[model samples]
Target chain A: SAVISQKPSRDICQRGTSLTIQCQVDSQVTMMFWYRQQPGQSLTLIATANQGSEATYESGFVIDKFPISRPNLTFSTLTVSNMSPEDSSIYLCSVEDRGEKLPHEQYFGPGTRLTVT
Target chain B: DQQVKQNSPSLSVQEGRISILNCDYTNSMFDYFLWYKKYPAEGPTFLISISSIKDKNEDGRFTVFLNKSAKHLSLHIVPSQPGDSAVYFCSVSGSARQLTFGSGTQLTVLP
Candidate 1:
């Protein structure tokens, strides 16, 4: 298990503006992932951030809208650009803890609640 | 198409009773299934998980049962407590290692 924290726990922004959420882990991790949970909806994976590579985004997400930066093994940032009311959601970051076995578990950060008005 | 499905949007159970949450997946290639609990304004917390090779896995009061043939899985919480009230999500992952989540079930444990 890993202890994770996100900055600006909750924020309200105007539409067409942008906000960047930061995630920091207590320990170094190889794989970090970003997720979004819309109101009354399931969590959707936004992108995967590795220490030294370009982030891999899910099908519906684009880099221009949600750019990610992984400067090191312990830190990553996700910026929601040109926000819209539809983009209001809780964004979370998770790290995969790989064990010697087949099943690996992920530990998550508390999440950043963003509301666009 | 939605790969994962959790039909029940909400469930209410009395304290000290049982709470059951069901989930189904359309893809047979998925090898891992997991359950997560979420409180308001918080991230989803890992509850339990089971591999495709195993029929069941237990962790404390939470147990996850997987049926690969039917592409179904369920989570059972015994002796539910009021603190257990939260939104539960069912997530599945395949070889790609990215999780696909079901639309969550909000469980309310009435005291």
Candidate 2:
């Protein structure tokens, strides 16, 4: 299990502005992921952040919209650019334990709730 | 398209009773399934998981049942508690290599 913390627990932003959410893990992780969740809806995978190289984004999502940065093994940031009312949702970060023997070992951060006005 | 689906939008269960939440996946390539619980203004916490090879897995008060043939899985909580009142989400991962989530089911454990 990992303890992950995200900054800006909740924020209200202007429609054209952007918000960058930071995620820090207690331990170094191999794979970090970003997610977007609407109210009372399931989470949607936005991208995967590795230490180096570009992040792998999912379909219907683009880097220009949600750029990710993973400078080290224990930290990552996700920026939601050009926010709109539709982008008002919870942004969460998840870490996948690489060294674990099990195939499905992952943990989530507290999440950043962004409400665009 | 939505690969994972939790049909129920919300469920109410009596405290100390059994609460069963079901999920279904459309992709046959999915080899791993997981359950997560979430509270307001928080991330979804991983609860339990089951491999495609197993039919059932249990830990303490939580039990996960998977049926590969029907492409269905379920989480059962025995003697549900008030603290368990939260939104539960079901997730699946397959050749896509990324986890796909389903619409969560809000479980209200009423005393």
Candidate 3:
């Protein structure tokens, strides 16, 4: 399992402000993903961040709103732009670890809890 | 529409007993399934997973059973512990490589 960490464990921001969440992994990985967990809802994939490439976003999410940056294999960031009360949720970062003998597994970071007022 | 569903929102079980959590999916393209456990203020942790080729997979005290025909899967924890009190989520992966998660089921193991 990989050790992943996110900055700003919890934060509260006013509407119209942006918050950038940083994700760092202990080891290098090929794929990193961002997810959002709304209150009373399951996790939703926001985008897939690959090193040296533009992030691939899932449906219902656009890059303009949730921009992702992956400068290298072990680090990435997700910025929630123009925050709104509806955008309040827990943002998570995950990395896929493909081992040589074991099956591939995804590990997650303790998410950043963002509340917008 | 919700492709994955966990009908039960919460469940309470006694320690030393078995705890079963069920999940159903509507998409037939999903061939990989995973279970994740999460506590308050923490991210979901990987627990167990199963492929479409197998009906059941076991890791220690945790077992995951999958039924392709019913598009249903269940996670069973034997001799439940109080520390296992957390929310469990079922995730499915198709050809897209990304996972789709079901609404979690909160499992409370009471002493």
Q: Which candidate is the best by DockQ?
A: 1
Q: What is the full ranking by lDDT, best candidate first?
A: 3, 1, 2
**Per-residue lDDT of model 3, residues A14-83, tens digit only:** 9999999999999999999999999999999999999999999998999999999999999999999999
Clashing pairs in 3: none
lDDT of candidate 1 over A1-117, digit per residue (tens)? 799999989999999999999999999999999999888999999999999999999999999999999999999999999999999999999999877765677888999999999
Docking class of 2: medium
Worst 10 residues of 1 chain B by lDDT: B40-49
* Candidate achieving higher lDDT, 2 or 3: 3
DockQ-better candidate, 2 vs 3 = 3
**Interface RMSD values, listed in order for every candidate:** 0.9, 1.3, 1.2
Candidates ranked by TM-score: 3, 1, 2
Clashing residue pairs, candidate 1?
A: none
TM-score each candidate: 0.97, 0.96, 0.97
* Residue A90 accuracy (lDDT) in model 1: 92
lDDT of 2 by residue, A2-111 (tens): 99999989999999998999999999887999999987788999999889889999889999999999999999999999999999999999998766455566789999
- lDDT string for model 2 (B1-111, tens) is 788999999999999999999999998888889899998877788899898989999999999999999999999999899999999999997765578899999999999
